[model samples]
Target: MRPDYPLKTDRLVLRPFEEHDLDDLHAYRSDPEVCRYLYTHCATLEDSADRLTKTLTMSELTEEGQWLVLAAYLPEAGRVIGDVVLKWISEKHRQGEIGYVFNPEFQGRGLAREAAEEMLRIGFEDMKLHRIEAQCDPRNEPSWGLMERLGMRREAHFRQNEVFKGEWGDLYIYAMLDEEYARAS
Candidate 1:
């Protein structure tokens, strides 16, 4: 069952992952800087390959809180620089959660935001989601800042919420409701 994908933006195409993305995926996924906030650490080549293969099967959300992962493709550069994950947390609640990762080289280019904005559109306008939220390590200024810049309000700052990479890490939750999205537009 292929998930409908290839969502596009001005500078990106959010499509399904592919075997060809192995090198690029490993390049970033294996970087400590990139995996700092993620649950897992730097991945080996086999790990990256396995991860990519798993992503290829998850192109759409499921009823049981599964993620619909999309590859962030830069057509001009002709490469996969990152990926986006939109998890369907609750169909009854119409709630969703989003996450993203991009190559460090593309950090300041606003590509993630652009791609994320499109995902927001997909959640709100297409999927009929009532709420969309994002959570990140409070130390990850870039991630939380990007969420705020996307018009999501800071809902909570949980202190020492989880033991991440050994030590407890604080978390920040950002969200935008459907009505809020409507008001923003």
Candidate 2:
């Protein structure tokens, strides 16, 4: 199993989803700007609640492909500003996947990266993952750039391989192996 939640970075607290986080979570998940690269369109309040409800049951995943979603809490702001997700993709392969979303209001800040770096530490050091990968829309520069900043290499760029939000979208995959992470650390 992975480490317990509330994983902290210098300026952010990454905690498991809670019953009361609906409003703060919805604020960003519902924003077109924030959901641009996400599979679903902007969320409704009910959609946010349903999403959070699913995450609440996912503090840890004993099975492959199960995901754990954590809220990115900003203490100074006293509210949730985003979320990070880590999926146990293949225990046999010791592989996992990571994803994230943040309010546009918080985009310029490095809070998302701060939270994501901690997730990497947990997946690599605590969970003993051999590799962690990430996929993002190629047009989402901020998203893929953040992955690069985390020391992951651009492993692939599939051309217009899938439709997202009713439109054709390209994809970029970034990944880092455990040995690479160890050397970087």
Over 1-185, each residue of candidate 1 has an lDDT whose tens digit, in order, gives 23456677899988888889999889889999999998988999999999999998888665648888888999988888998888888889999998999999888999999988887888888788999999999999999989989999999999997889999899999999999999887
Best by TM-score: 2
Point out where model 1 deviates above 4 Å: 1-4
Provide the clashing-pair count of each candidate structure: 0, 0
Task: Give the per-residue lDDT digits (tens) of candidate 2, residues 1-185.
Answer: 74665677898888888999999999998999888788988899999999999898877767888997888999999999999888889999999998899988988788888988887887898788999999999999999999999999999999989877788889999999999999988
lDDT of 2 at 70: 85
Task: Name the 10 consecutive residues with the lowest summed lDDT in model 2.
Answer: 1-10
Residue pairs that clash (backbone atoms under 3 angstroms), model 1: none
CA lDDT of each candidate?
Answer: 0.88, 0.89
Predicted structure with the largest lDDT when compared to the true one: 2
- Name model 2 segments beyond 4 Å from true: none
Model 1 lDDT, residue 75, Cα = 93
